[model samples]
Target: MITVVVFFSGSGIGTSTQMQHNNQASSSARERHPNSQIPLPQSNYAKHESGATRDSRRRKLKKQKVRPEKRKAGNLEYTNERNIAAHVSRGNKDRPIHKFKNSFVCYSNNARTKAVAVVKFYPFEGMDPERKAHYEQLSTNLIAHTRFQNAKKSNENTLGGTMYSLGWRKGFEEKSHLGITGIASKVAKDQEGWIKLFTETPWINDFLAQRFQDISLGMYREVKEQYDQQKAPSLTPFYMADPESFCGHLSFTFDNFYNKAHKDEDASPFRFAMWIPINKQTGKLVEENLQVEGGEFVFPEDGCAIDFSGFNGVVECVWKASEHPHHTLPSSTAIGSSDDRLGLSCLLPDSAERAIERMMAVEDGEKLDWTIQDLGHLHNDSLKYDSKGKPFETNDGVDLQASPPSACVLDEDSSTEPDKSLSSQLKVATPTQLHRST
Candidate 1:
């Protein structure tokens, strides 16, 4: 199948090598020699049970004829890296819907562009604790943001604009180059670092290569040539040698499971090129949120939807976005669901380089706003104002300096809240501007 996507499901193993090893072990154990009894892993639900007690429980379930999908994929317990396999699918699995861009012959399970297909990664066993914790905390932050704990209070009631965007450049206007102008990063460096999260992800990069290898090999080779000239001598193919020629962009949409159904106008030069970044653990969180609310991904054209509500498998999805006209279902979960429903868009180095060039060449590189335009390499749209009627800046906007502050998107790990006045806040809609939304 034309599955050029690797989702970080349950455990987020380091590489394919680890995946093969785990799968092989599972296969070997399943090769039961006609009579020998095999034991399932200890489940969290019965962690306190003695061996005999667990064995008795399994016997009971077996006698009851329990199916694999009704519970975990394996006999593993309810750990964070629980290998439930929680597999889900939709549409006709049989038959190819025509070869996608035909670099090689393959069919995409998610190939139904009009009706976007959502599938998750094959589950693996055991995950690193640190990584698991990282995902949990991120989810916590997302929920907190939604609850207003992380929100900077705002009183602006004017028309910001019609287009909404995420990610911003430091010391620059909020609405330039893939920007939602008034929304600045609480910490400057976070902008760049967020972009790297997807570009450097092992599976993400590998899958990107696998899915588009033939069509993109020539383009990758061209960059690899110049990457060879770097002085630091990093061995990775997608190394960040320089922002202009290297670097990437990661823009995202954060909301609950419910929203208006509209075509994702992301087919713009930089958007159709982006991909989703989700590892196993993060995928689990997304699925759980889906269960609470916002039950499915809907295709507006035919009003067809794949019910994703209630842990119905929210996992890694990859597509040639430009080729798809799609929209997603609003989340069902709301309270304490800051990190619940998320859609991320990423720009790898090749795309970023081209975007940066276009950004620099804007207005013959003369727009004073273009000084920090490189930030758009990741976010791609550096327009001071989206083509709509409103301006990006408000009379009371934060007073930024001519030169960007030394702190930037990459340095967000130790982010200290910038002055509350400069922090980004959800724009409060006034009675008059209620017609426009951010």
Candidate 2:
């Protein structure tokens, strides 16, 4: 059994150390009193409890037995860190299935003080069925309202694609990388339903933040501080499910989503991904009543995968994405155009804080309309410029100075309504195009 190691509170006492000490003490006592019978120590509450009360407590413990399906060893495979590292180095190619029985915290072997990853089951612990159904329905609705772009480059066997992202993004000034800044990723004009869903449902952000804090305290503190700093007064476009989410960005994907093995080397350590299966017919959680077989989140490096079919509610996997190379296996049962699984990921890029700071510091009127081409890192010396600060034709014969802005840029004293026009101008490229470009 791959048992989870539970950490105990207090300064120097470890669970294993305490158990070993107790065992040793018991052995020593038995040696000294070979013929004597030693009475076992009892808890104060147990000693004072009535017979009926004790009987009731015993019955309750007995009723909470582990279910047989959860006990199936077919779902779990365990491997050590060394093996995992080796697999990653070789370019992860194999898919391993595992049953997710319990939530566990993975600490660094070299530095036990650092918690590198966490896997949580039933993240929506206290949510009643009705509430779970509501979230499931919202997820389905989001899928309907938004358009998914193909992730062609790293998709598994072309059975992939169907991915999209939302939140703050970094880009440079028009025709120049000198003024790199952050902005909110916008959806298409027709996708107003998706925008309204997030604006109207503020609790969704609260739920994400609360649950994020619940699993990892240290990570939550750092992320919360970053978000608070980003909320400072600014004209920088802020479009997200929740501006306060520890996740500066979110990506949603659907329709038999499966990706080739890869690592998000640029992502921050504070990252989490979720999978919620919805029934196509009823738009409700599949749960145990229905099954969406396969679509396991596989960690080739770890030699294991999280099979969601065994999960009754949403499962959130938080890990060091920069270090882990993972992919997914296609769903055997829920395949084709009717794929019902909805996937979500909360990500913070390693450069997110710096980008947000740059975006916030920019004064209202100086910001320019940046196209997707300006987002890449470019050297200032690479472009030819005259003494008057005017750009010349590049080596490729492309005139940077002649490039047109994606939207209309009006003067400060223009007759048009500034607020409405500025807001409309801010919606540069739709998320579908932006995601594909990224």
Candidate 3:
């Protein structure tokens, strides 16, 4: 018996003259919070909504008409060499930055895959100054609320920082505890501030939708197909549901950060992961400054890097992170100097694909009436099934291939006692959660 469980709600760039001061401010903010365990910033983003209100928000988001600009494919800047083998580094210190003379889109020389693309584009080029500032302030607060625990080091110990994963991720039975389809990563407060940030930040969403229009539309279609809008109303995505989100996961890296070459698991090679660098001081977007140095996006595997050191406006790197071994040179306020820098990347995780596979396996005629909390009894391994109708085994050593009749089985004695695990107790609204109309 597959016990049905509840579904949960799920839940930019800028200018110049405005650019210089913004970076300075961001650096200052990082200085103030340097490793301090301050409380999460208050709820200045959005108010908690009832289910009815959430429905209203969804209708509004659908009707909004935001379109992305059409960039010419002719502007692409092609590189010379193709790297077929994996990149080998000798003590992270030997990596060099590739400095380009002009701003252009980078494409690896490989005729076969064309796996990486680094474009020099400014996300907030034409936006209003005040509005851009508002976005920055909110971002700064979000950064301040975050406390880095372990320094996520790449290349052994060459580059590292306090990393925070904010959006939806694959459900782990022992970790997330909910064996259901997908779950949101935890934030500072009971997700109050985080939810507000997701809902209130429409400008950011619109920018992402516009910048990666094709990917956004593709993800929207995939989501709709997996969870029918009418049948799985509880699974409605957050913000303005339309194409506000292109990917299911977001990762933020705060001050003292650089990446050693690495590949993301379950990443989509066909879809690009969007990377936006921010000034750690103001939480504003990272503007290009000839005087500022470092922060070159390097792909050791490809023997190339996109140097953001001297660009005119802002820079955004859209690359196939799942297919490439990439890293970044430490960014600073000036050449050979150190300062706070923040980075964010957006991608759809493989776990989500697994979750969707499980969800689609359910009989179409059945109504998904379960709540998010009820998913605790489901096992992640049982969530995915082989084409032969056998459940796959997860790393947790759950013998799911034994052909158990029900995926969710409570041990004989605990059915009445009620297991009080953390997964079964969560109740919060996220961007992914949508309301069902009464």
Candidate 4:
């Protein structure tokens, strides 16, 4: 019987054979060990590669392949500097959207001392036909003004400070060199005119200051009258609803240069007063009077007052109202000063009430009580006064003559009565006590 022997070797057998070979080799190597033994042969199939060595070899190869002509000097340095600057400047570019182009300079003393310098750059997008036509006319007019051209030559301080001119091809060259174009020319011209007007004209500055003062005063008077009419006892709680609006009076007063000491003892070089309106909803002062030209709105040791200068040369006044009296300490919570009385007055009683009602109803209304007071007082103070130091009164109770002595005092012990003619029929008492019983 020819029976073929069937033999099946499992995968484990192959592993066993490999293990046996490894063990035999290790044993032989151990047996051959000596004081100075030869190292075992390394397997060519078991090569060890290091990342550092591989990278070095790659770099060497790359360098060898690149031509010397292709290399640039300082290129790497420039790239590094550029990258660092870009990283540093990234935050600046992401600044708040409301950032002002001009720096605002605020002054507590004089409006003329305040200035704003704004820089604006313009480039051409698509031009409007009307704008282009306007520019063309403007350019023509500029050229027609020979005096302007002569002024440019004679006065080095004139428009010559700018780069563009209507002269030669060299003018165009300068334009191109500075990257200026038609649009840039137009912008420069407009800006130059504005700068000149702002910097060179005193009357212009005064006019602007006067206008701002007037507007501020008008707003303050209206607000004060509204508060008075409401007859609210105090304005100490409404600061949160609109802190900005409530503080508008303070800002206006400060800006107009109203001195607070004027209302203290009538000793200030300038006369002033302040009329603050309290918000009914929040019970905090809403707004103050704007400083007028002749009289000044001032805060007394107590309530507020607008002291006039000899009746009406220029009305200067400031008005401020807060939830708490600004000049007083927390421990001393009394209202009214030694000089001025506190209480709502008829002069502007309904002013505050009307304003509050309108504000609640979300309507816009305005009154000019402060202006009337300013002008009327000035007119009445101009009337003649009697020997008793009382201003001569008319049948209509309006003073038609200027006070005999402009330096007449309105103190308490003085039997001198205010010329009734000069006083407004409407008088609003403050909420606080009068500093002196008049």
Candidate 5:
């Protein structure tokens, strides 16, 4: 049976930065935490909405207008390499200090009517004090998690992206959250070494707690405030990865993992989402964004590509997954250095947090009249699928295939679940805004 869940955030929904600190990434792999010494981001970013602000369908967009204290941030310093950032007090009173923060620009598919925006604040967002605090807390939480114990390195430790996941394998089964038995190998295991950072954050539940309504509506408010448009689509944002952390992948020499052009999983919200990455050496907790040499995100809907190689931190208003075909260039072919990639991600707003609570309810057997979009388990760590959710071949021109692991961490042949890739080929169902079941 296929269930579809759709949550829409309408015009009556509520609402919810910028500047540059051109600080280069640090040399050491030390983690960062909240300290009084850190300066706040300098941007005039404030958003407020009430019931009175219902008609967003015809709202008009204004250029980036900053207040007295706020200044438009400088462009990200493009470099020959990539990295994320934390604090290293120069203590030089004469020199200006720069910390990472969020910034955005508004746009439309046709450059005319309905508008959407790209919101970015990754590696850091210094402008909003509240969000900055949350970033600090999140850093601290991940740092603590990574310190728990030594990890068993996988035998397949080879070249490619080094991302990891911390959730159960049976994502669609009842009590699936309890199914945590699984093993990772190769580049994934390398990334898994830092997996605790995601599994142990204090607000992880808040991140995973988003529902369709929260996402669709949040996108609405972001675009509404920026473009003053009357209508926002019901874009249900799901974590690019399942209820887990797909920390990151470092595109190494000859590794075909980072170059392919494709889309991310369908649940990702295109308008106003954050893309945060960190230095592989900086430990798991810190968010030190990298400006990868060739990692420019290509947008199909708009025919544009953004190069993060120069940007300090990322906070973009991306296109909805359903509407766009996005891909990045090959990561720099460099050996282990500050450019080596790794990072944690996800920050669900108020609406999405409540959706998570409702998900818990559904798991608890409270039947609601909602369409359950079943985005069957894609095994987030696999290199087989490109960012566009399409199959990819390695540098050797071979398709890398592996079965999803069993809940008990058994061999490939031991998988107890059916492969959704085959099931999806059968045209599973009419995918809802919420999820697409296998």
Candidate 6:
């Protein structure tokens, strides 16, 4: 009978003894295989399985070790590159990416006509007390020296002539008190009163005499001498051209007006309908159908309307200028259309503040708190007028208003909501005198 023995040991004694026995058997088999093939021992098979298990463990360990190291190295490289790029971008200061943001257009409306006013609000950032005083003086002088009038010459005949010679040279002071000052006061004090006043006031005609005088002084000495010798010096020589002669013409016609009549409603400020005229023949707005550069007319886009919910006071109006047919259209047409009209660019406190901040961001690395109170610019020098029916030599200065406190940090606590009730009750008057003549 054959006898088989089985032994078990907790410390792997049995397994060790078996492995030793397998090694001896494998050596004997290899010696025999020198001349003949020999089957592998069972113990040798167990060793082979152990070797495979060890290899699999080594492979798992290698995969686990390499993956995280590669990830960490890649992360470190990315972070280092980002830091270097940011440092380089910050170090270069000569980049031309920043510019001033103090320009804006202000539009006022009345019963019969809408007037668009443009202003450039200069803040009190770097200005000392003396500079502030100087700016205030400039504003006062601009108001004091400003004037307006209806041209004496017919629109058809004065296409390229001086404003004074055209026959309209009325001073702003001589007209009714419902001018810019009056409207500004109403806006600052009583919202409802201002709304009513704006709808009822008549459009004034005026040109700045001081500005015309300045332009006259800037003329070449030779030109001045020739005019002096002829005794027929054109007082407003700059304005003797077609499109320049018709710059300040207010000819828009009104269509409708809405009176919300509530002080707390969001839509109460002012709303009006008007017709922007384009020459039916050429599909443009121009004097005598002459195609002039920068003389295109545009109306607001369809379905676009003013929203006054966030403003304390909102004023909206339409502006129309005759443009040459060959002129390229503006990229944005939100305010106007191809049929000879454009829409007014909308403004809010946040947007105006953004503009001011952007302007200040460009000047120097130094930060400034600039409050833009108002923005506007003077017309081209060609629109000046003199006492005698001739163009004025001086150029008019545009009025810019600014207050230190007007610009404040934009925070959640700022109260920018418009007077809802007052804005709602206000009505746009369509029977305005300015609309009839246009």
Best by TM-score: 2
Output the worst ten-in-a-row residue range by lDDT, candidate 3.
67-76
Model 2 clashing residue pairs (backbone): 75-98, 75-99, 76-99
* Model 6, span 1-438: residue lDDT tens: 834455766544455566778898878888877877666535745667777798999999997888655544432332211111110111233443221132222222211122221112223344356534433332222222112322223323223212211111111342111111112321333333324432221211112222222222221222233322222201111111111111111122111112111221111111111112222223333112221223212122211122221121112222222110111122222133322221111111122223323432333334334322211001111123222324333345443333222332222223222233422443311211111000
Residues 47-89 of candidate 1 have per-residue lDDT tens digits of: 7768898789889889567554333322122112223222222
Please give the lDDT score at residue 207 for candidate 2: 62
Candidate-wise lDDT, in order = 0.32, 0.50, 0.44, 0.26, 0.34, 0.25
Candidate 4 residue-wise lDDT, 202-256, digit = tens: 2222332332233243333344344333322221111111211211110111111
Best-first order by lDDT: 2, 3, 5, 1, 4, 6
Q: Please report how far candidate 1 places residue 403 from its true position, in Å.
A: 8.0
Instruction: Provide backbone clash counts, one per model.
Output: 38, 3, 24, 75, 54, 83
Off by over 4 Å in 2: 1-99, 123-127, 148-161, 170-195, 229-243, 280-282, 334-339, 350-438
Candidate 2 residue lDDT tens string, 127-183: 776658656755765555343122323323335647655444443344421121211
Candidate 1 regions exceeding 4 Å error are: 1-118, 121-131, 137-247, 257-291, 300-306, 312-314, 334-339, 347-355, 359-369, 373-438
**Per-residue lDDT for 214 in model 2?**
57
| lDDT (C-alpha) at residue 293 in model 2 | 66
lDDT per residue (tens digit) for residues 1-438 in model 3 = 644444444433344545566777767777898886544434534455577888988887764532111112222222111211212222344556445433344445422223255444444567568645654664664465353112333326245556765444444444231121222222211233433443433444445445454333333344334334322212212211233344544566655467677876644443333344456555666544433456766767555666554444444455666676777777655544333445666555566555434443444355433222222222222235543434456789684553322332222221211223422233323323333323
TM-score of each: 0.35, 0.53, 0.48, 0.15, 0.36, 0.17
Candidate 5 lDDT for residue 123: 44
In candidate 3, which residue ranges exceed 4 Å CA deviation?
Answer: 1-97, 108-115, 123-138, 141-159, 175-195, 201-203, 214-244, 270-293, 331-339, 363-438
Better of 5 and 6 by TM-score: 5
